[model samples]
Target chain A: MKIEDKKRVLREMVLHRRFEERCYQAYIERKIGGFLHLYPGQEACCNGVMEAARPGHDYVITGYRDHVHAIKCGADPKEVMAELYGKETGSSKGRGGSMHIFDVAHRFMGGYALVGGPFPLAAGMAKAIQLKGGDEIAICFLGDAANNQGTFHETMNMAALWKLPVLFVCENNLYGIGTAIDRSTAVVHQHKRVAAYNIPADECDGQDIEVVYEHARKAVDHVRSGKGPYFLELLTYRYRGHSMSDSRGYRSREEEEMWKQRDPIFILRDRLIAAGEMTMADYEALEKETDAYIENEVIRFAEESPEPRVEDLEKYVLAERETQLPWLTGKAA
Target chain B: MAQIMYWEAIQRAHDEEMARDPLVICMGEDIGVAGGTYKATKGLYEKYGPLRVMDTPISENGFTGLAVGASFLGVRPIVEIMSVNFAWLAMDQMFNSAAKVRYMSGGQLAAPCVFRSAGGAAHQLGAQHSARMEKVFMGIAGLRVVTPSNPKQAYGLLKSAVRCDDPVFINEHELMYNMKGEVPDGEYFHPLEGSEIARSGTDVTLFGYNISVHWCLKAAEILDKQYGISAEVVDLYSLSPLDRDGIRKSVSKTHRAVIAEEDEAPVGVGSEVIAIINEECFFELDAAPVRVHSALVPQPYNHTLEKAAIPDHEDVVKAVLKMFGKA
Candidate 1:
């Protein structure tokens, strides 16, 4: 990879790491309410894959653990933070809250709450792109657990049959809430599951940004070149629990420590330094800058953003005025 | 005026919409080459080509989700679920993603698509195939549920549903495919919500939708001819928004109501109609509102048992006669 590109990737990874750490702190302080899923350990997977995909052209969708993916795909951090705050200024105008963040202009489809829900949506988007006559592809991010959902198989078959431009990216964090991959998934190798449909799939180390980026480039190129749906699996882990409510007694402290030692952000940082592309002071300065941005700018923006009004709660339910709500009008229109 | 079958009306509507808009596309299990199970999409593939009329695998959730996702990017996908019985598999995509995408996204996105399925019992199709899940769909907030009772509405409402900027669940009956009614030539858009008085009367109002509307109309004739009771028939086509004013006006004039539905009792369409009458026209009502619904049991495979399951002309007449103390 180019030195400048490497620095840029490292910078984005640092930003995502610092931003999510602050999000964790804010959640503890009760500033960010509802279910909070931090993306500290899996920053490299998001940054690498999203960086490889074109922002305006390619579409990105994922499950609820999607703070970093939105940011990486050009969604403003302030708007995203405001969304987490349930403010009107948020990306989804407070309607989606933390789980549903969408920026149509940025081509970030959304963060669906249901497992395996985004796959069909992504395939549909890919189909739409094909119908509309475009080489653009849709990238869907699924957790290790979601690979077992019926929608995963259904969507994969449709994407392959119709030759839709979609890349099904599975971040295998080894656990689906409390269930491990071995316990939940019949096929432990998530990428191998897609082989049943004759689609090409690859797996890479999610801890290494360079490796993930390399695999993502080939995968994105294949889909963008109209090679049907591609499945790329990143063997990763999550440092935080499933949500704020999860006690996380399912895994041990030693397992957490082992994964923490292979943190993607630090892995990239050490690689850049060893190659003389970046120094330790440079990494620290970048990290400090990102921390300052989130602590001061992002947090302040979310804090100042106004919550959506009670009156406008019914807005966006329907596109136009086809049917009337009984509560809103006292009678149907 | 041109008389056409229910399937012909639906096919014409698809033809007109697909010709007018290039963005409009259709997809389902047998919609392309096989021309749909009910032939609702007959000749669409040959006319618009395979790209516009897509034949999808037997994956309801998959294709349904794909349609919703495609709608996100401005391609209006008219998805078919073959039968409402199969719609259960795609309910997650329908409710979670398609129905809630617009509201949950805070207007950042909208799924202006249509999902049409041939539903309800016909020819003793048995328990699994006999599905009138309109009550369940009507309960969902973001979806627009419409059931057409005649060819005119099958044409007009579908044209309107295609033009609608929200997700529309069109409940087309399996038995109604061959039924014919008068449809005016040229383009017309019907109202997606509100009830239409199929027949006017002053004594009692008999409300029904889809196949039940025909029963109500026949019962109205029987009441007027056999008995001296003047019965009105109101077609509650739009189940979700439900023409509250139309219903109120009809019930207030008649002062009596008998809601006929093919669906089973308890929290179904008839129960909703009863609730509306109880709330809006309780004072106007002289007799207690009666619900002529199907037997509260799984539809049987036996022909005689299946015939006894859902409400018919006799059930509607008996309910109306009892309401007027004529039985």
Candidate 2:
């Protein structure tokens, strides 16, 4: 990566962390509501993989911990924040709240709420690409626990069978809500399980963004070059509880502190600063700029945005098939 | 017009649509090389080749979700669940994902995929297989549920469903595949909403859909000849919207109604029709509308018991006669 790209990526990691922290603050301030899943420690997984591929051309989907992924995929930070606030200007027009942020223009397919539900969808997108004879590949970012979903096994087999262009990036945060990988999954190592489907797999330390970016390049090449689906498991940890409701009583404090010591943001930022690629003043300046932008621009847009109008409550039910809701229309009953 | 079997109509629709747009594809177990179990997708695998005519494994949820996901990117995939019974495994994809994608994504995305499944009891397929799942699909909000009574309807509805820019669940009947009717020689797109007045009448309305539409027609024949009762057969093809205006118009004209369905009364097609009648045309009703539904039990395997378990033309006739106080 070029020096400029390295510095930019380091700044993106910091921006992602600050954006999520602002979301946590907004949740407490009653500015945002509904189920919010924040990605604090797993920044490298989304950034590293996405950086290796074209953001607006390629497809990206994940399971609910989506704010950062959408932003990284070129979704407007204001629009994402407005979606969390359930505003009319939100990404989903305030229909999906936080779990369903979508930017079709950016090719961020969506963030589905169901665990492992995106498995087949990713394969399907790849199949479409193959049908159209396009070079774009579909990438699905899901937690390690999502691998246990039946779609996981079924999709892997089909992707391999058809040689569909898709990359399965699993962020192994060690737990599915409260259940540990050992208790929930048979094979603790997620990449090894892909052997059953003959898919080439790799594992890397997710906290290290540079390592993630390096391995992800190979994975992206393998899938985009028509070698079929590739699985990349990034071993990372979450800083906060699973959701706002999670007290996180199930995990140990010592383990949390241990993982935090290897924080992905700090790792990338410190490395860039020590290499003379970025000065301490530059790092502090970038952090302050990102903080101000999130506070003044993203949050302010969300706070000042209007609520979705009531007339649109029944819209989007069908594309153009039924212009009106059957019941609501004067012609129906 | 060309006389064709119901399955042939479905096949022709697939061929026409696939030829019309290269984006349209078919996926299901046993649909490619072995042909579909009902032959609804026969010979297309050789014509369209592997990618377009995909024969998937026995993972209903996987392929169904996969097809819906493909629809997001402008690939129109028609997924055939071998049986509606097997579709139970894939309802999450159908109801939660395909149905809700457009609305949840705030119109930025659309899932224009069509899911076809053969349902209803046919020659004692056993309790598990003998499912009338139209009610389940109809209850969903984002999906458009349509059932075809004959070859003409099967062809037109499937074609229209493919062109439709929304998720549509075509609930086909296993018994109707071999049944024949005249289909138009030219391209035809059936309306996805409203009921079809299968037969015109004045004294009573026989409301039904899919297989039940045939029973209503048969019963209407018996009522016209034997009982001299002019019973109108209203084909409630659009189950999701329930054709409220068409249903009310028929019921108001007839002054009485008899809803015939293969499903049991509770929370099924019969119950929904009755609710619409009561809410829309209660004053037009001269007497209480009666429902002719199957016995409230899991369909039996034995031929004799199965015959007793399901509602047929005779039940529809009885329902009409009783409604007119001539039974």
Candidate 3:
């Protein structure tokens, strides 16, 4: 990657981290309700793949920890925050909270709440691409624990069978809620499990953007070139508990500190500074700018946005429900 | 008008729609090369080839969810589950993903997919195979559920379902594949949320759908000839919306009602029909609405036991006669 783009990525990683911290604060303040899964420690996983793939062109889907993926795929952070706040102007029009940040126009298909839900859907998008003869590929971002789902195997076999262009990026964050990967998963290495389905697979350090970028580019190339589905596992950790209510009693603070020592943003920033491409002052300025933007623009936009109208509660139940059932909308048949 | 079998009508709909737009694709086990278990998708594989008429493995949940996902990208996929009994495996994809995605995503995406499956009792296929699962699909808020009684409906409803920009689950009966009827020559799109009056009458209204509509029609004939009762048969093709207006209209005119269903009574189609009648047309009824349904037990394997377990035209006739105090 170019130094400018690398510098930009460093800034984005910083922005994503600060943005999520504010979301954490907003959740504590009760501004954001329902389940909120923040993507703090795993920014490089999604950013790396999204950078390698076409952000706004390639179809993207992931599990609930999806704010960063949506943003990377061109979803406005303000609109996303507005959605988190359940505002009318939010990305999902406030109907879907944090778990379902959908920006279809930008090809960010959605952030599904159901674990392992995006597998077949991702392949299905690839099928659509194949049918349309489009150059686009479907990029599915999921957690390592989601690999245990039956859909993981089912979709792998089908995508490989049909030669669908799908890149399954598994961000192995060490735990699925309270359950540690060792306790739940039979085969801890997610990339190895895809061998049964004959999918080309590999794993790398999710904390390092450069490593993630290198592996992600290779995997994306393979899938996009019609070599069938490729599974890329990025071993990582989540600094925060799975949800707001979770207390980090499952793992030791020593382990958390050890993982934090290699924080993705810090690593990228240091690398850029070491290469003489960026300075400490530049990093500080970017951090201060992002904090101000999140507080003033994103949070404020969400806070001031209108609540969805009660009468329009049935807006998205079915796209054509009004025409299909005219009586419901008080239209004459 | 053209005369054709029920399955052929479905295949014709597939052919027409797939030809009309390349986006319309079909996926299911035994659907492509095998031409579908009931031959509903017969000749489609040869016509559309492998890409358009793709065959999937026994992974119902996976493929169904995949089709739902494909529908997200405007690729209209008609997923056949081969048998409705297996739909229980794919309900998460149907209920959680296909039905709720649009609503949960605030209309940013809609799964314009058609899930077709053959359901209901069929020649002692056992309890596992005899699902009568339309009730389950109907209860889901966003998913559209429809069942066609004949070839004409099989043709038009499938066409309309392919065009609908929402997830539609067409619960076809397993026993009705060979049933023949005349369908319109040109394109015909059936209404997805209304009941058709198969046999109009004044004395009583008999509510049924899909395979049961045939039973209801037979009971109607028996009532008119043997008992001098003019019985109306309401083909409830659309189950999700329940066609409350049609139920009210029929009950208001007939003043008496009998709901016939092949499924067990508890929370089945009969239960919903009775509930709708009570809510919409309680005052119009001459007597309490009665339901003639199969015995509340797992469908047995033995022919005699299976025959006794499932409700047929004879049971409907008995219910109508008993309701009129003439049995």
Candidate 4:
């Protein structure tokens, strides 16, 4: 990779870490409600893939731990925060909360909450793009637990059979809400499972941003060439509990510290410093910039955003003017 | 127009839609090579091929979810469950995924899918296969439920259900498969959520749907022949988004009403119809509304018990006569 590319990746990782830290604080302060899954230790998997795919051309969808993914995919920070706050200015207009964030303009399909639910949707979107004669590819992200869902197999089978343009990325964070991958799945290597569908599969070190980017770029290229769907499993970890209310009793504190030694953000920062690509002053200035940006977003979402009105709840339940039936008028006999 | 059975009408609708639109597809167990269990899709596989007419494994949830996903990608899929009793296996995908996707995606996605299956008891098919579960789906939002009483309505409504951009449930009665009725030919699409008044009269109104509509018509004939009373019969084709105006207009002219359904009495679609009429035209009614329905019990396997469980023409006649103080 070039020195400029390394610097950009480092800057993006720093922004993601700071943004996640702000989300954690906001969640604790009651500014953000509902389930908040933090992406503290898995920044490289999100940043690396986002760098490989074209933002407006390639579509992206993922599981609930998606604040960083949305940011890396170029969604406005103010709108994301407003969505977390359940405000009308949010991306989904307060209808989809922390778990579901969609920005159709940027080709970010959504951040689905159900396990493995987005796999088939991503495949469908890829099929649509293929039918429309567009070269756009769909990248779907899921956790280790989602691999056990039936939708995973159903979607993979169809994608491979039809040779759809879809890239499946499994962020194997070692644990699914305290249950280790070994305990949950029969095979520890998650990538090999997709072999039954005859799709190409690979494993990459998610902590190394360059390695992640290289593998993801290659897999994405294969799908865009219409070869078939490709599965890329990234070995990573999470630094926080499953949610804000988890007891964290399933894993020991020593296990947590052992994985913390290979934190993606810290490793990228050290690599940048060693290569003389970035100075200490430059790193500190980036942190300050990110902090100010997040602070402005918090203020904009809290003070300027308005709550969704009571009458607006019934809106968006159906497509506007899509049905010609008269029963929707809510009139009496 | 030639006379056709109810099942043949459903088969014709599927064939015509698949031939008309390339995006329309059908999937179900034993539907491809063996046709459907009831032979409703007999020659579809040979005509449309495997890609459009698929034969799926017995995994209801898996195939149902796949149909939902396909619908999201702009494919109009008509998914057939062998029987409505087996729909419980796919309830998660139907109610949670298919029905909520449009609303949960903030109206960005639409599920243009139809789940068609045979419902109601067929002689001694036992308890498992004897349920008239149309009421269960009618209670759900974002889903349209239609039960056609005759071949003509079946042909029109099935085509409309496939074309509509919503999740529609078409409940077909097993006993009505062999009964023949006149049907229109060529391209036709009936408007959904509307009621059809089968018989016109001025003394009493009979509101019913599906097979019960036939019984209500029979009882109306008996009232005119034996008691010199005229009775009007209304066929409620669509259950959800019901045609309230049709029922109100009929009751206003007749001044007496009787609602009949093929399911149990308490909290059935008949109850809902009666509630709507009472609220809308209470002052126009001369007598309290009566409902004719099956007793609340699991359908028995014995022929005599099964015959006694469901309401027939006699029950409707007795209910009408009692309402007119002639019992």
Per-residue lDDT tens digits for candidate 3, residues A87-158, read 999999999999999999999999987889999999999999998898899999999889888888899999
TM-score of each: 0.97, 0.98, 0.97, 0.89
| Candidate 4 lDDT, A171-226, residue by residue in tens | 99988887888899998899999999999999999988889989989988898888
Residues forming the 10-long window of minimal summed lDDT in candidate 3 chain B: B184-193
Clashing pairs in 4: none
Evaluated on CA atoms against the true complex, candidate 3 attains a DockQ of 0.54
> DockQ-based ranking, best first?
3, 1, 2, 4
The number of residue pairs in model 2 that clash at the backbone is: 0
| Candidate 2 chain B lDDT trough over 10 residues, lowest sum | B318-327
Model 1 in CAPRI terms: which quality? medium
- Residues A29-147 of candidate 2 have per-residue lDDT tens digits of 88889999999999999999998998999999888999888999999999999999999999999998889999999999999999999999999999999999999999999999899
DockQ score, prediction 1? 0.53
lDDT of 2 by residue, B108-225 (tens): 9989899999999998799999988888999998899999999988998888788778899999999999999999898877777888899999999999899999899999999999
The regions of model 2 sitting more than 4 angstroms off are A321-333
Per-residue lDDT tens digits for candidate 3, residues B1-327, read: 888999999999899999999899999999989888899889999988999998998999999999988888889999999889899999989998999998878888889899999988888799899868887898997898989999998988888888778889998988899998999897777887789999999999999999889899998998899889999999999988899999999999999899988878888888998898899989998998899888988879899999999889998899889889998
Candidate with the larger DockQ of 3 and 4: 3
